[model samples]
Target: MKIPFSLPVIDADVIAEMHDTLTNTGWLTSGPKVQALEKELELFIGGGNALCVNSWTSGAMLVLRWFGVGPGDEVIIPSYTYSATALCVMNLGATPVMVDVKEDLTIDANKMRMAVTSKTKAVIPVDLGGYPCDYDAIKEVVNAPEIKELFISDNEKQEMLGRILILSDSAHSLGATYKGVPCGLVSDVTVFSFHSVKNITTGEGGGIVVNLPEPFDNAKELAFLRVLSLNGQNKSAFEKNQIGGWKYDIIDQGLKINMPDLCATVGLAQIRKYKNELLPDRKKIYNYYVDALSSYNWAIIPPFKEGSTESSYHLFLLRISDISEEQRDEMIRVISEKEVGVNVHYIPMPMLTLFKNKGYKMADYPVTYDLYKNEISLPVYNGLTEEKLHFVVDTVVAAYKTISGN
Candidate 1:
């Protein structure tokens, strides 16, 4: 029996929703379904204005672009996160100042504070492994008088906020919460991915919840971003289809990153069952992994919740204590040979070829590499049979035992 790493939560409801969207919904691209998805997401995360986009990268890039992140501008990000976080900054011709992460794999708040500079436009903190970062601490860093003073606003959007933008890369943390509040409400703007492997899947889509503080109207900003996502055209295809609505003008040089109704359909369908059914089910699996593995001498189970912060149960990142990078690789080989698929959450950005050649030294981020070397992400998706779950646990145990000879 081959146990895969992760799977999209595609049940009957998802299929039915997609069918209705493709066949019944007259507007396919960025229409009613997308609007409904945005509304549902907004309400689900409590009350931030959520906007659906083509992808997480697009949504985040739109935020960076709105803030006028360009050549000479620096955006702080954790070296432990996915490449998209840094790629969004680099794609916009801005520099990504990488920092180490905490034990929980979330960006280190102190490291982030030190990375802020006069040219710093934004800080993208990644909620790695479906867990929310220490948002309260991160907020303090960005809200500090020194950090605010160091920020130089070059665009109207930045000037309006008058501080460093905290654009959360919450790709793994939609249902996650910190301080009893959802991820969206903690950051200035939180971007969630609906990639197949994420907690929520929309084939390929993203949602952005705007929570920019006072003196800045979030609704107005959301409206402007909608136009920006539609390629500078003031009128969308759905709007233009209406009577005499074809007459529109190019507002600015914008991007084509609007979410289609079809993709939004899946996200909406899944979200309807998220809080009560889906999230709890994943959390059950995460808890089971922790409970079953906690007693082992070599196993180092990652925390799902600390203080008031809780994970969305995205990935069960179980670390093998006292293991070298090479031993971890060997353990993975043994697990794979047993047909139980496992994966590393990430190979820290600095260790990657793209960043390594660009002067990003892995040694600089010690915490990130320390976690990366021994970590192994297990599958935590919907519809894992009881048998499969036990099989996975047994396989991992045997693999580790085989490698450790204990």
Candidate 2:
């Protein structure tokens, strides 16, 4: 019953893929395998071209730079997300307008409307715990007449979109859907994480999907991103090593953030098993948690389905009713002593030191803090069995009862 909070699903097949890659290819950095991974991801997403990068943070930074989100610009983001979402904005010397989230733990569209000003360049709606944000609603808010009138275009990409950019921070949700539409097709641009703890893993990697509408060619953007991922070079090392290809040009000064072939090899192996094994197995664990915890009065389960939308079943954010933050901590401690693993989804940015120093106040975002105080992310991974799942639920319930003096 010693369950850890999460673990990567790296089997012998994945290892063999890496070994095969090393044996067959001498060029490891941003080579054919990276291109192949991007192609496979594009196909899996059903539309939109994909670009693989070393990490989601790097991908986000690339998107910001590509869109020309720099000094004096403001990028809106939810307070209840990982710091990377905001840090990426900061990296470009832009201001991050921290906003609140709704009960489902996604960014509140109404708050997004309130946060927008003439200087607002973009809004990054995070898919917390693998749940897709309400892109249609967010788009509507961004396209409102009042807001649209204030928009000042900064780059060619920004002018083509004709409004504020909806850059989705979909780090937790890869295979998720909204109204039967895949994540890659929901926003103007979407980013996915393949971190070790994410649903898919590349040891450490991420993907970017360009979904800008008609008049903006996604293929051209894909090519542009490939160049940007390397140091804005016209040719990758593999291409430069080819016959008479050594002569190349520097397009622009870009960051070095391309995904290496070694990591892409793991991504390829995981994706092959994704639709068949990884997704289904994770779904089973999620269902088990819901069924086991349904009878508990304090259990507030995470939302996996709402109308035609479905989560990728990334992390389970379970909330405890009427519990103090101290009591929640005590319960987690008790569960850990019993060898059942649990964790918090996030600590609101307003409560963190960096954001506090930036003049963000926790009191302003009551809903975000409320969600963070009582939420616990339970053990949900690839190989968790029914028996281990039961132990997890039972341990959590017992710990709560003990801590609450019920």
Model 1, global lDDT: 0.89
Best by lDDT: 2
The residue-by-residue lDDT of candidate 1 on 1-406, one tens digit each, is: 9889888887899899988987887778888899888988988998989889989999999988887889999999999988999999999999999999998888899999888889888899898888888887888988899889888878788888889889999999999988799989998999999998888888999998999999889998888888889888888889998888889989988999999888888888999999999999999889889888888878898878977789999989999999999999999999999888799989888888999999999999999999999999998998887789899999999988888888
Per residue, candidate 2 scores C-alpha lDDT tens digits across 1-406 of 6899988877898889888888988778878888888888888889898999999999999998999899999999999999999999999999999899999999999999999998999999999999999888899999899989889997788888878999999999888999999999999899999898998888899999999887999899878988888899988888999998899888987889989898899889888778888998998999999998988889998999999999999999999999989988999999999988789989888888998998999999999989999989998899898888989988998998899888
Assess the local accuracy of residue 96 in candidate 1 as a C-alpha lDDT between 0 and 100: 96
Alpha carbon lDDT of each predicted model: 0.89, 0.91
lDDT of 2: 0.91
Which stretches of model 1 miss by more than 4 angstroms?
none
